[model samples]
Target chain A: MENPCIICVAITGSLPTKANNPAVPVTVAEQVESTQEAFEAGATICHAHVRNDDETPSADPEKFARLKEGLEEHCPGMVIQFSTGGRSGAGKARGGMLSLAPDMASLSVGSNNFPTRVYENPPELVDWLASEMLEYGVKPEVEAFDLSHILKAADMHKKGQIKDTPYVQFVMGVKNAMPVDREVFDFYIKTVKRLFGEDAAWCAAGIGAQQVVLNEWAISSGGHART
Target chain B: MENPCIICVAITGSLPTKANNPAVPVTVAEQVESTQEAFEAGATICHAHVRNDDETPSADPEKFARLKEGLEEHCPGMVIQFSTGGRSGAGKARGGMLSLAPDMASLSVGSNNFPTRVYENPPELVDWLASEMLEYGVKPEVEAFDLSHILKAADMHKKGQIKDTPYVQFVMGVKNAMPVDREVFDFYIKTVKRLFGEDAAWCAAGIGAQQVVLNEWAISSGGHART
Candidate 1:
């Protein structure tokens, strides 16, 4: 039988406003509930972003532990992924997620001018993050915002920071990153295959309306489509 | 001196409704004016989709002739590109733009289900289109919707239909096309480079807000940026 496509539902992201979608989870209970809903919706992975009780983004270890515990209790078999992205420009802030030691954590490979903000992950910090992920047995999902980001990921893999076959998530549709278009998509995918080869597992995520389009392309390109 | 970036502005696309953006030009005169504005805004190339006087989408050759004439009169140096994308499944409905035979015409490399529509270009038709572009001295901008589309472009190039060192534009962020995201961006770029090597001149066009992001990435990636 063919392997089922791995569906990962990002429950609470760092950027989405309550004004955009009312269903975004904020509290611990809300995060747990959202994870459950995503699992029920056929998501094999649940990406958690811990939020303060007041709905502000948080990377507190306690909050992550609570979320992990709650998710494990609610959906035992679901893969739990945590966001290591601290607030923009706060590279040191990624430590919170690392302390929790979840099964997986994001490692943004390069810096780009994100929407209404600039994300500058210094190369030293990136190297340190990669080492930490490896030492902790935490899978690092290389969050690449552009082609250079993928190159950075490949560099880490070459340096033995990441496993030979690492997981890469292409984040598009953000300002200063790759555009949400077919040509950009082709360039990005083609670049990854060239750098990492077919041994690597890849996924795609697009902001806003691009989300659906990116998912469909992932399916067509024989890559895993995450929700 | 650094190579100047080639900016292709879609002065008038066939898809956007007036309600979405009133600035969208509909008539031939309006398209000419928009093209001139884009030229002034540093766009050396202009991608056009003709519309009827009633604001309906049109591929009428006369409309293209009128627009071309206006462009030639207003901006002599600007490269005008015509869209071969007929509405819906009416692929044979070539009209104004195809007849005018401008310097460039978009040749979609593959067919896929568009939102509520289907776009299919058979191999025979692709070969014919390629021959037509070559015969008319019009360069074919192979518009790839996915990875397979890039392969198709490579196949056409191998068949000597498309010119060696072919010019390609990856169109992402369409519903049925590749996603406008980083992973897709990496894969697409890597694939094109691998298939076409250093000889190919490529660009990326993202739908909506992704347009800016993709353009920026293209500029940084050592390719010309065309909207």
Candidate 2:
């Protein structure tokens, strides 16, 4: 029998507001309800980023605690993943929720260009975040903004900074960063296999409207996708 | 017969001060004397940066003009390439030397993490530098600190931002940035060929002890090398 795919849903990202999409969940209750719906529809993982009352992104552990509790009660067995991305906060603030000990958290192992500014994940910060995850017994979803990021994850894993084989997600189609290219995508898979053994698990992500394109690519290529 | 390799000698960089090595040239006179020796030793290109009296980096075009004049008189035909890297200055000041119209200038297309901080090459700065190079008729040596940078160079070429096929340098072995790996080195070559035609020119650079390794790889794989 074919191995079942685990679908991950990003409930509320660091970006996007009611002005962009009125249905984007902002409050804690809205986030839990959204995750419950996605869980019912077969999303095995819930990737979350908390938001303040004013619709700004937040890295509040209290909100995460409430959301984690609600998800446990409403969508039992679903893996919870909090975003440790830079958009919500800076420095250690981004990882403040790690102490809550969710199933997993997004970790960017290297820096790259975002739309207008540099998404900074300095080496010290990367090591600190990985150590925090190790302490809390949480798995990390390595965010591969470019090819080097995936390779850096492998290096970190070998050095014992990461406890297990790093799970990398190839992100594409972000403006001024990596764009979607068929050949580069194939190479990314080859790199993952070469670095983390042939049977290692991996995933791919596409921003905005290109998410559909990544879904088709990931599904046909025997990897996971994020929505 | 094969295409002869063009050797580029970077006499002084933004980092690595005279304190690290007494031989590291900091003054205009010292830099000229160093380049004269390297030029005579078959170095076809001289990549340079200027410094203040106190040994700190400077973006002074006047100093650059003096260096260009000295290189012309002392090492005629040796390609003079000024560095527009962020370490020496901020914003437009980084490109102040472009008006000198040296043979080339280094331009970073994307951002990545350095050893201790973010190597910030924001989009606005990148575009402005490229445009300045275009106006001054200076060829840009696109510094590819990571894989996405090479792709960004290709995109700029397509949009007419870069006047010609970019000369990309794949840099590796920096902490929190791309590290030196054989497979990745090979992939960088393939990516360069895939983006820019098969005949397009490229290069590779490595920090500290990895320089020898990248030199060997670049030469054997039919690309330029910076020493």
Give me the candidate number with maximum lDDT: 2
Q: Write model 1 residue lDDT over B1-227, tens digit each, in one string.
A: 45777888887688776878898888777778888888888888888788776677787777788888999998889998888874612545642245567989888755443444335555445666778777777888888665556666776788788876677787766643355767666666777888789646799888877888888888888677766
Q: Give a tens-digit lDDT track for model 2, residues A73-183.
A: 999999999999999999999999999999999999888898898888888899899999999999999999988898889888999988999999999999888998888
- Candidate 2 wrongly placed segments (more than 4 Å): none
How many pairs of residues collide in model 2? Answer: 0
For residues B1-227, could you state the per-residue lDDT of candidate 2 as single tens digits?
57889899998888788789999999999999999999899999999999998888899999999999999999989999999998899999999999989999999999988888888988888999999999999999999888889889999999999988888888989887889988888888898888888988988888999999999999999999999
TM-score of chain A of each: 0.93, 0.98
Q: In DockQ, how does model 1 score against the reference complex?
A: 0.02
Clash totals in order = 35, 0
Q: Per-residue lDDT for A28 in model 2?
A: 93
Error of 2 at B175 (Å): 1.8
lDDT of 2: 0.92
| Per-residue lDDT value at A38 in model 1 | 80
lDDT of 2 at A115: 86
Residue B55 C-alpha lDDT in model 2: 86
